[model samples]
Target: MPRQSAGILLYRKTNNELEVLLVHPGGPFFVKKDLGSWTIPKGEYDDSEEALAAAQREFEEEIGSPVTGTFLPLGTIRQKGGKVIQAWAVEGDLDADAIVSNTFELAWPPKSGKVETYPEVDKAVWFSVAEAKTRINEKQAELIDRLVALVV
Candidate 1:
C-alpha cells in the first residue's frame, strides 16, 4: 500500500481576509526551496492508527502546540510520488514566528559521515488563500479549494 499521511490546515480570518497556516521544511534539501515547498504540518500513519488522531498529533509535533477546533474535512489528495495525504481544515491561529518544531537527524552530504540536526519544520507562515495556493505543494492545493467551498 502507498504511504498515508494526515494533517490539519489551520485557518483564521483577519481584517475580513482568510489566511491559512503553512510550514516550510527544514534540512539542506529544502533550504533553497520556496514556492511549492510549503505544506500542512503533517506526518505518516499506519493502519492501526486513526487518521484524525494522527493529524492532531502531527500538528502538535510540528508546531509545538496542540490544536483543537471544529475540524472540517478537506478529504484526500495524491501527490506526485503517490503518497496519499488526508487533510482537514480547522479554524484557528498560531504565531508563525514563535513556532518550535521537533528535530530530526540526517546524514548530510549524502555518503559523508557527517550528521546534522534540523527542525522538522523550519518556519510557519499564515498566507491568504491566493498566496497559499502558490506556496503549498501543488498537489495539496486542492485542500485549499475544498476549504473555501466548505467555509467561505
Candidate 2:
C-alpha cells in the first residue's frame, strides 16, 4: 500500500485576495532548493489513526500552533512518488515569521559520523494562489486549486 499523509492548508483573505501558507522543508537536501519544494505542513500516519485528527496533529507539530475551526475538505491527491495526501482547507491566519517547527536528526555530509538536527519546516510564507502554484509540489497544487474553487 502507498504511504498516506494528511495536512491542513491554512489560508487567509486580505483585502479580497486569497493567500495560502506553504512551508519549506528543512535539512541539507532542501537547503538550496526553492520552487516546487514548498508544501502544506503534513506527515505520514497509520491506518488506525483518523486522517483529520492526524492532520491536525501534524499541523501543530510542524507549525507550532493548534488549529481550530471548520475544515473544508479538499480531498486527496496522489503524489508522483505514490504518496497519497489527504488535505483540508481551513480559514486561518498566523505570523509566518513566528513559526516554530519540530526538529529531526539526520546524518549530514553523507558519511560524516555526526548527526545534525534540523527543523522539519525551515520556514513558512503566505503566497497568493498563483505564487503558491509555483512554490508548492506540482501534485499538491491541486489542493490550492480546490480551495480557490470553493472560496472564489
Candidate 3:
C-alpha cells in the first residue's frame, strides 16, 4: 500500500488578505531548492491511528507548537509519487521565526559512515494564497485552493 500522511494547514488573515503557513524541508537536498519545495508540516501515519489526531501530532512535531481550533477538512490528495496526504485547515496564527522543528538523522554524503542530524522543517513562513500556490508543491496546491474558497 502507498504511504499515507496527515497535516494541518494554518491560516490567518492580515490586512484583509488571507495567508497560510508553509514550511521548507530541512537538510542538504532541499537547501538549494525554493519554489515548489515548500509544504504543509506533515508526517506519515499508519492505519491504526486516527487521521485528525495524527495530523495534530505531526503539526506539533514539525512546527514545535500545538495547534487547537475547529478544523475544516481540506480532504486528501495523492502526490505524483503516490503518497496520499490528508489535510485540514485551521484558523490560527504563529510566529514563523519562533518555529522549533524536531530533528532526524540521515547518513550524509552517501555511505560515508557518518550520521548527521537535520530538522524535519528548517523554516516556516506565511504567504498569501497566490504566493503559496507558487511556493508549495504542485500536488499540494489544491489545499490552498480549497482554503481560499472556504475562507475568502
Candidate 4:
C-alpha cells in the first residue's frame, strides 16, 4: 500500500488578497533548498486514524498552534514519491515568524555515525496565491489552486 499523509493549508486574507502559509523543512538536506521545496505542514497517518484528525494534529505539531474552523476538503494528490497526501483548506491566520516546529534526530553527513537534532520545519511564511504556486512543491501546488477555487 502507498503511504498516506494528511495536512492543512491555512490561509487568510490581507488587503483583499488571498494568502496561504507554507513551511520549509529543516535539517542539512533541505538547508539550501528554496523554490519548489516548500509545503503545507503535514505528516503521515494510518488507516486507524481519521484523515482530518491527523491533519489537525500535524498542523499543530508543525506550526505550534491549534487550528479551528470549518475544514473545507481540498481533496488529495500523489506526490512524486507516490505518497498520497490528503489535504484541506481552512480560513485562518498564523504568525509565520513566531512558529515553533517539533524536532527530529538524523545522522549527519550520511555515514558519520553522528546524530543531530533539527526542527521538522525551520521556517514558515505567508505567500500570495501566485507566489505560493512558485514556492510550493510541484505536486502540492494543486492544493493552492483548489483552495482558491473553494474560497474565491
Candidate 5:
C-alpha cells in the first residue's frame, strides 16, 4: 500500500506578496538538502486515523506550534515517490522561528552503533510563491499553484 500523509499549506499576504511557509528536513541526510528538499509540514498516518486530525497533528509536530483556521481543501496529490498526500490551504501565517519540531533518533552512519537525535523539521520559513517554487519539492509545488488559484 502507498504511504498516506496530510498537512496544511499556510499562506499569508505580506507587502502585497503572497508568501508560503515551507519546512526544511532535519538530520545529516538532509544537511546539504535545499532545493526539492523543502516540504509541507506533514507526516504519514495510518488507516485507523482521520485525515484532517492527522494533518493537524503532523503540522503541530513538525512546526512545533498550534495552528487553527478554516481549512480549504486542496485535495490529494500523489508525489513522484507514490506517496499520496492530502492538503488544505489555510489562511494564516506563522513566525518561522516559532517552530518547535519533534525529534527522531537515527544512526548517523550505517552500521554505526551510535545514535543521534534530530528534529523532524529543522526550521521553517516563508517564501513568496515565486521563491517558494524553488524551495518546495518538485512534486509538492502543485500545492502552491493550486492554493494561489484558490486565493486569487
Candidate 6:
C-alpha cells in the first residue's frame, strides 16, 4: 500500500472571498521553487495512527500555531504517484507573517556524515482559492477544488 498522510485545509471567508492557508517546504530543496511547490500542512503516519489527530498535530507542528474551529471531512485523494492523502477542512483565519516552524534532523548535503536540522516548513501564507490553485501542486490542488465544491 502507498504511504498515507493526513492534513488540514485551513480556510476563511473575508471580504466576500475565500482564502486557504498553504505552507512552503523548508531546507535546501525548495528554497528556489515557486508556483506549484506549496502544500497543505501534512505529515505521514502509520495505519495505527488516526487521521484527524494526525492532521491536527501536523497543523500545530508545521505552523507553530494552535488550531481552532471544527473540522469538516474532505475525504481522501491519491496523487498520480500513489501517495494517499486525507484532509479535513476548517473555517478559520490565521496570520501569515507570524509563522513559526518545527525542525527535524536530517543528513544535510546527502551523505555528509554530518547531521543537521531543518525546519519542516519554513513559512505559511493565506491565498485566495484562485491563487492557491496555481501555487499548490497540481495533484494536491484537487483537494482545494473538491473542498470548495462541497462547501460552496
State the local distance difference test value for candidate 4. 0.96
lDDT of candidate 6 over 1-152, digit per residue (tens): 89899999999888888899999999888999989899999989887889998999899999988787888888998887799999999998788878888998888789898888899998898999999999997888988998899777
C-alpha-based local distance difference test score of model 3: 0.96
Any runs in candidate 5 off by more than 4 Å, and if so which? none
Candidate 1: residue 26 lDDT (0-100): 90
Summarize candidate 1's per-residue lDDT along 1-152 as a digit string, tens digits.
99999999999999999899999999999999999999999999999999999999999999999999899999999999999999999999878999999999999988998999999999999999999999999999999999999888
Candidate with more favorable, higher lDDT: 2 or 5: 2
Candidate 6 residue runs with Cα over 4 Å from true position: none
TM-score of 6: 0.93
The estimated TM-scores of all candidates read 0.98, 0.99, 0.98, 0.98, 0.97, 0.93
lDDT at 64, model 4: 94
lDDT of each: 0.96, 0.97, 0.96, 0.96, 0.91, 0.89
Q: Write the per-residue lDDT of candidate 3 for residues 2-64, one digit (tens) a residue.
A: 999999999999999999999999998999999999999899999899999999999999999
Better candidate by lDDT, 5 or 6: 5
lDDT of 5 by residue, 1-152 (tens): 99999988988998888999999999999999899899988889999999989999999999877779899999888998899999988888778987899999998787898999999999999999988999898889999999999987
C-alpha displacement of 6 in model 2, angstroms? Answer: 0.2
Question: How many Å off is the CA of 19 in candidate 4?
Answer: 0.1
